[model samples]
Target: MLHAFRLAAVICAVLPCAALAHPHVFVDVSLTLRYDAQGRLAGIDEVWAYDELYSLLMLTEAGVEGTVDPGQMAALRGLDANWDPLNGGRLTVEPPDGPAVLAQPRHLSTQWQGNRMVTRRRHALSPPVAGDGPVFVRVYDPTYYVDFAMPSQVVIQGRAGCQASLQSGQTRGQDDAYAATLRAALAQELDRAGPDDVQVDIGAVGADSIAVSCGR
Candidate 1:
C-alpha cells in the first residue's frame, strides 16, 4: 500500500493541476482493537482490501495472471515483510500528550481475496497502553494519495465492554482545499530545477478516524 502511495505521490508531484485532484488507488480498511488476557490494550489487527483496479495493477506488476502462483505469493509476502506501514506517519494514535507510535507488527501477510488484494497484519501497541478511556485512531495517508475508507464496522476483540465508532473526516470544502494544495505543490515541484522545499500537511484535509472506548 505504501508502494502505491509513493507512486501516487510522485504522480501528484509531477502532474498538472487537472490530474492532481483524484486518488489513484482506493482501499477499504477494517481495524480490530485487540486486548490481552489481562484486558490491557495489546495491539490492533488491520485488514486492508485493495480496490479491483489497484489489485489488477499489483498482479500485473508481480507478473501473475488469475490466481497468484506460489512464487508470486511468496513475493507478495516478502513485500509485506519489508514494508512497515505503521511507521509511515500515516496512522495516528492519540494518548493525551500527543500521538503515540505503535510498535512493530506481527502476523503480517498478504493474499488475493477474490479479485482484490487483501493485507492483514497485527500491530503491537508500544508500551502496551491500557484502553481505560477513549482512544482516537486514524488511518489515512496524510497526502491523500491513496484514499482509505472503512466500509466494514470496527471490531473490538476480547473485550465485551469496549465499543468503537467512526468519525468522518473532511467536509466537501476541505476536500476541495486539499485538492488545490496538492495541485500547487505539484506545480511547484515541476517548476523547480531541484527538489522543492515546501512541505504540505495534507492531514488538514480531514481523515476517517475511529474512537475506541473501553468501559471497565
Candidate 2:
C-alpha cells in the first residue's frame, strides 16, 4: 500500500493532466481521506495506487523494463507534483499552479442530495504539484464516490459511456445543463467554506487514477 501511495504520488506528478484513454475504462481508484471507522472523509491521500505503474513507465521509457503491460496501464497527461517546505507538504499539479490548501471543517461532510452529494465537502488542499480532483479531488474514497454511474455499463471504445463516464445525468443533449446545475450546487457549497478550511484545484482526471489507489 505504501508502495502504491508512492507510485500514485509520482504518477499524478508526471501526468498532471490525467490520462484516461478508454471509454469502457475500469480504473481502480481510491482516496486517502482523514476518516473514521464508519467511513467518513476527514482528510486527503495524495499518493495512492499507481506507484508500481509509474515506476514501470519510467523504466519502459528508459528501456529498463523490457515489454510492459500496455493493457494494464493507461496514458497519463499532466500530474505534476511539488514539495512545499513552508507547509512541510508535497502536492500534485496540472495547471494554474494548483488547488487551494485548507483544512476540512470539523463538521463538514458530503450529504447525498438525490442522485449525487449536492453538498460541498471540506476536502484537503491539492498538493502544490501532484493534486487531484473531478469535483474536489481526493475528497471521497471509491465507496463514497458516485462517479461510476455504470461500472458494468460498457459502451463502444471512445464513445462517452464506453470509455469515460457521461457525468451523473448526461445521457441526453442536456448533459451540459446537468453539469451546470451540479457545478452551481458545488460552488454554493464551496462558497461558504473558509479559505483556511479547504483547498481548491482542477484536473478532471478520470476516476481511473482515483480508483487505483483506494486503500493505499
Report the number of the highest-TM-score candidate.
Answer: 1
Q: lDDT per residue, candidate 2, 82-134, as tens digits?
A: 12211211222122344445543222232222222111222343332221222
Error of 2 at 81 (Å): 7.0
lDDT of 2 at 108: 26
Task: Output the lDDT of residue 23, model 2.
Answer: 24
Poorest lDDT segment (10 consecutive residues) of candidate 1: 80-89
Model 1 lDDT on a 0 to 1 scale = 0.66
Tens-place lDDT per residue, model 1, 108-190, is: 67888788888887888776667775788877665555777853378887778887788787645345655566555555555
Please provide the root mean square deviation of candidate 2 (C-alpha atoms, Å).
Answer: 18.7
List the global CA lDDT of all models: 0.66, 0.28
